[model samples]
Target: MDYAFAGAMSGLVAGIIVCPLDVVKVRLQNQPPISLTNYNGTFPTLVRIAKEEGLKGLFSGLSPTILSYLCDRMLWFATYESFKVAISNHTTRKLDDPFVHSGSALLSSVVCVVGITPLWVIRTRMMTQNTETIYYYRSVSHAFKSIIKKEGLTSLYRGLIPSFLGIAHPLIQFPLYERFKIVISNYEHHSKLEDYNPNKRPELSNLGILTSSIVSKFIAAVITYPHEVIRTRLQTQTAPLNKNFSNNTSVIPNIVPYNGIVKTVKNMVVEEGWKSLYKGLPTNLIRTIPSAGISLWTYEMILNNMKNI
Candidate 1:
């Protein structure tokens, strides 16, 4: 019934459904510009991962992925709902107003991004870890311990800036969703007046909600995709090898520092061209649309059911 609980449940379901796609996306995004290993595309990458590493590979980092999203979505919805209520109390506008919803979504996303950045860093590192590479993480705990011990606490927040930029995603998505809801509701009301069918109204609302979720997610993902690439690069950038671990012999090459978001974008464009900023975007869309739609549907369903109870 609680917003946080509803969000966490919805996120857990969405994360599980989208984990395989996410693993593929992360692998594709984390690839070096001029690497020996590169996936041809989403299907080929999926096949390769499955053939080489089996199902486990497809679900790599599922634990941390779900955990990160669970917490992230919980914080996001809880904060957004709380902010919406607080703002509505002060403002003349209705709580459901698109501007208020958008503002709440943006602020909530910023807060959640800060809180969940480390978990996301861990999830990305774990997902992108190639066993063939010298550095391999055994588990979520192993990844966290290794990263903290080797890279310091700040490493966990490596992509915080770009992630903050990611607030633009929900800012756009929730506003569009609210606007779409209003438009769809108005259209459905007109249709019902002509047809005078009460039974169909709920169905129309449900369809509108799902459609809005999918459309908003797609648009937001495309516009904000470049930030995703930057965030992945920042998070996956490895620390310089420790001299003490020199004898270990199985050290993966360190990732070149990405500097800051601006420098990183410039460097990527120089080395790999502007298209590089949208690497894995296709896969990202495929994953995000359904994931977001399902999440919104689930969240709304749960909230409604809880309200009835």
Candidate 2:
């Protein structure tokens, strides 16, 4: 099986299905810092976006998000497979070695972050801004050009630091996922994982993979979610709006541009409390838990069928 092809399909499926939820999550994350708008919960936020902005609102960043996943997952799985193969060959370690999974995923994440941060910056802007704002971007390419023109080339990689920090997510997740696969295989008395095979054992079925993905993803997400909020804020955040605007009648939350990660996080905690750091957690969980499971399941299914063919 072509790991690249399998990963690409997995990303496309997951990105499209979870995009609406992603918009909600970003809006929630972006809003709290400035008191722009308050979102109550996941379902409520989804309902509000649909009611006010319609389907287009829900899918605002669809193009960039889709492209992001396609490129990200293609690089991710391809790199992982290459790293896994190389490490196992050199060290004579089993393919399932924990270091193999963790190292591969972390390296793959770095590759994705470097390659894809600009897409994410564009996506965040598209999601948070409408036609009214100076930052609103119509198409992905327009956003790309506009950001560079207006804010300079570095703007496209605004949240790059936190994005690199986000590697911790897949590092924790893929390794734990591999560990879980080993557990399931052992539980079923099967020596090899069903990662690319569905007929070996019923215990290592789709359900097992799904469960592993959900548990690993959920854990990783919970631990790493604050970085997500910080990253979004940095990406969509506008320049410091009217330094003396605090004395004015109305003040926008985008008043402060998040500068460094530590300063931004410290500011969020001081101003909005620690909860602000986890602004979109519930929505994120709802969107991502199943999304991860589905992504892995899709990749494995594609790989399995392709191998059989």
User: Which regions of candidate 2 deviate over 4 angstroms?
Assistant: 189-203, 239-253
lDDT of 1 by residue, 1-309 (tens): 289999999899999999999999999887877676678799899999999889999999999999998998899989998888777778866666777888799789889988998899989988987665766777778877777887778888988999989889999998887666666766777753334332221334678779978998888889888999999998888767776574222246534558899998988888888998999999999999999999998988888788779
- Please report, in order, the local distance difference test score of every candidate based on alpha carbons: 0.83, 0.81
Task: Return the TM-score for each candidate structure.
Answer: 0.92, 0.89
Minimum summed lDDT over a 10-residue window in model 2 is located at: 243-252
Residues 78-165 of candidate 2: C-alpha lDDT, one tens digit per residue: 9988888787788877677788778788878888899989988888888876434444566899878766655579978888999999
Candidate 1, poorest ten consecutive residues by summed lDDT:
193-202
Error of 2 at 270 (Å): 0.9
Tell me, by lDDT, which candidate is best.
1
lDDT of 2: 0.81
